[model samples]
Target: MARADGPRTANGPRTGGGPRADGPGTGDEGPVGGSGRRFAPWLPGVLIVGGVAFDLSTPPPYTAAPFLAAAPLIAAPLHPLRLTALAGALAVAAACLLAEFHGVRDWAQSATEIATVVTVALLALLINRIVRRGSKRLASARGIAEAAQRAVLPVPPARLAGLDVAARYVAAERDAAIGGDLYAVQDTPHGVRMVIGDVRGKGLGSVEVVAIVIGAFREAAEQEATLEGLTLRLERALQRERARRADIEQAEGFITAVLAEIPRGDSQLRMINRGHPAPLLLDGEGAVRQADPEVPALPLGMGDLGAWPDRVEELPFAEGVTLLLFTDGVSEARDAQGTFYDPAVRLRGRRFAGPVELLDALVADVERHTGGGTADDMALLALRRAPVAPGVDRGR
Candidate 1:
């Protein structure tokens, strides 16, 4: 069931377009304005000063009530309860002082103006309380999501089966900690087996598929004797999930994945690619090569469409060489100008101390290329064959 590559293409560098307004760098400091400055914290003070100046310069007919009312509103979301209260108090005091300075001949009008200021100030405090409560709820929700993500995709050990391993999962959506992207590595009697995949959808649905795929892989990696058999196990798992759910959408969804096996004491690794981005091989000499599948196969869960024999391709995985497997998020990442990021081309001449360094650099490079505006979740896994010492035994 071989199919052509997806429509996304990797081309030249980005041509034009400024950085995204919501791109990385704007942290809890405050919201960024059009001028790209953190002016939220100072806005209330500026408004108060401006209101005072306007009242002093203008006649009593032209009141600065609008400016005075806006000061507390501006501070509501950006400042704490105490600061917000202070801002409201200051605005009310300014209104009273201005009214007194004008020598109010109309007591009703003066009372109305002061009353309006007090009312707005009270509303601002209410807004501040609501915003703070919502923020606390959001923070608590994020903490729970992070914990779930860790449990679902627990970090692979730094060393596994004599190989240095590292993995990373980056979600494109700011509020999401986990999505359809997933990866798992396990040391089995067969050797170190790794799987990286991207499910077809997003949100909780995709997360369900991710959990199914990974759960199947962990169990199969221990029992399956070959990469081909292991791939079948994953396909069956997804098939069962769809059958159990009995939903048309779940039935239609598929997962693009790569299964890799590194036999103990062997200098080569075997891989079975199921319509996924080809893995990259980086050698000690800082040269990179792509391990594209000899024959493409449809992604898993698409067995209903067609079936083909899974082909296991062997590649050199000698000492000081690192193998990188990733989801389409990395390969399909586009810049402001729509040029897809090509990891092989970008990492061609880069040398890293180990798998951890390699993945860190790749993640940073992808963020830079996309200007931190990736539209999908990314999952990356890299494993390096540790260099053997002069008299060290290579046997497990």
Candidate 2:
């Protein structure tokens, strides 16, 4: 709730299935890294030799059975099925050879050691099969999750209503590909309009609300004549959704959002803030302005508490000035000592050639500040007014 000087802070409609799925990306590195593959062939050999040496050095009653048993186990996840089988065979053969060298080949203990190696070898092979199967299943699940993410949050076109647009959604969880953050940009009859919002909670519930908000925004952005009108439509949509849910969910669910409209043949932009973060306006000369709302209003779905008329704040939308919109993930990112990240301070004088570079820099700066320890999901959208051609009109 702390306000900063003009530079206060730094910095999708999808519809779909009953429940959403999520996953991280670590599984993609399965068995293919330089270090892993480089040592793969020699690791089994080293283990076998080490097991032999341990067995030879130990007293007659003691054994290196554990080391001998581990050779195939280590190979199961890192090597091919045939290589795993070979590792198991080598371990069994080594145990047998040691038994013979010690003159215990005919002893019951030797047979038991040999049998133990064989049983472990077979189990290692089974483990190899299970790991491979799991990897395949994981790959399949990742693919489906990515597909769902694309369907729900389609990438905005590079150009929208004559403005350059770039958006990014970074999930806080490493394995998670998507979260509750959402954005949508459309070239509507009224001009170009965009909405960015953050759902209150996480998981399926948040995703469901995101779909509802985006679906409603898309429908209203094209038809509503004013930014305030579109916001009212979004509020009604959230209210209807709340009505469909139980009392607990109705009491808890809410969405913070910012809606903007840039009318054609005009040099100014209009915005409606519904308890969302103020967007930063960056000029071509590297100046920044925080477009905070003049009248505060509750986030979407809290109309029951109190209702205030949405105020449309208008600001100059000069050519080459980029407008940045984001969720609390960016504003609330804390450093190790708990100091909040100030995008206004970090990016005050720094300039980027375009929206993409600006967002890339901002994200990198946040990571550096938090030492890569962000707690909430972040969604960023950067829109810049394209430079007019020598003969083109500035507003048309």
Candidate 3:
């Protein structure tokens, strides 16, 4: 079956208001105010007032010096440098007032406390400068990660060969935008080919593997006519990558992936699984089942461990049916009580309008299950066969 053609690529750099692969954010909101930002305007006031009350209620030796000193340091990261300086001035002024009220202005302890406040206020200003510099560096790092993510996993076109498609990726580390999880979709001579996989390990090494696998897939998906042939190409690609790295990575590296093909004008889907989690097959009635492989297989890059022929599992891909693919991050997400999330159980009996809706709901459900924090990178792809429009030709 040949690919049904229109626009082959949908997810790219946003142009003329097209959907963005990286989502929308200007990166302007920093450690400053939202709810926490609101507290900044009054935090120094509360600290100063509390300190004054403490000094007044206690003896001369019992000073609010510590609170007076802390006020400015606390404000440094949450407010502008000017505001931080103002906070320090308020703390110092509060200390002076307390010293006068207690009639201890001439005492050595009072003088010591005044000097401490002044010195700390100056130190707080320095801390503020350091923090601002770090924030700028952090923002730059985030920008680089975002760019790498977009390049490694360009967004799948929203519509591919008449299928409604959407993909989402969530990195385990919130600030780290890219990780080992990967997905790719391409219109090839055979069909609309797609792959979702997770590389073992983390950090720059895993990201490097992700880039290599994706680059290989985009090139080989067009040439390999059979799913088995495509799987072999990927295996060789990873093995070659491992050979260039140190012996430790070569010994430890492996990837679990599922490659799939949806042919035009056919109600059948072909898949090759390499020890990855099974893709979920969802029907319009909201029933869900795992598209488990007919034969078990080892993960890619582990060819030396064992030799087995890669098998292709063909399944029904009926109208209004959706295929859901994901990495282990979705399955292994744990709740506070130490319970692992099972997507099969959670998605049963739940109907979605389309692939985009299913992903939004699934991601939200996982967040609620794991209390909004997952320890592994997540990559998800949903492809659905749109119901044929009335009076439209069944065979194109």
Instruction: List candidate 1 stretches off by more than 4 Å.
Output: 1-30, 33-38, 58-61, 393-396
**Candidate 3 ranges beyond 4 A from true positions:** 1-41, 57-59, 391-396
Candidate 3 lDDT (Cα, 0 to 1) = 0.82
Please tell me which predicted candidate would have the highest TM-score against the true structure.
Answer: 1
After superposition, candidate 2 runs with Cα above 4 Å error: 1-46, 53-63, 101-106, 392-396
Error of 1 at 217 (Å): 1.2
Please write out the lDDT profile of model 2 over residues 1-396, one tens digit for every residue.
Answer: 001111111001123311122211122232367765576556666677876775565445445455567788878887879999999999998887877676653365566667777898899999999999999998998888788678777889987767989998889988677788889888888998999989888787787788788889889987888888899899898888787766326533698899998887677999988889899999877788898888887888888888778888999998899999999999999999999998877889888999999999999999999997699999999999988788875432
RMSD of 3: 16.7
Better structure of 1 and 2 per lDDT? 1
Query: How many clashes does the backbone of model 1 have?
Result: 0
Between candidates 2 and 3, the one scoring higher on lDDT is 3
Model 3: per-residue Cα lDDT over 1-396, one tens digit each: 001111111122333433223211111232244764565456666666776775565433355766678788877886789999999999998877766655542455567778888898999999999999999999999999899889999888898887889999998887988898999988888888999999888778888888889999999999998888999999998888787767427533689999999987788999999999999999999899999888888898999887788888999999899999999999999999999999999999999999999999999999999997899989999999888788875432
Give all TM-scores, in the order shown.
0.86, 0.82, 0.85
Task: Report clash pairs, candidate 1.
Answer: none
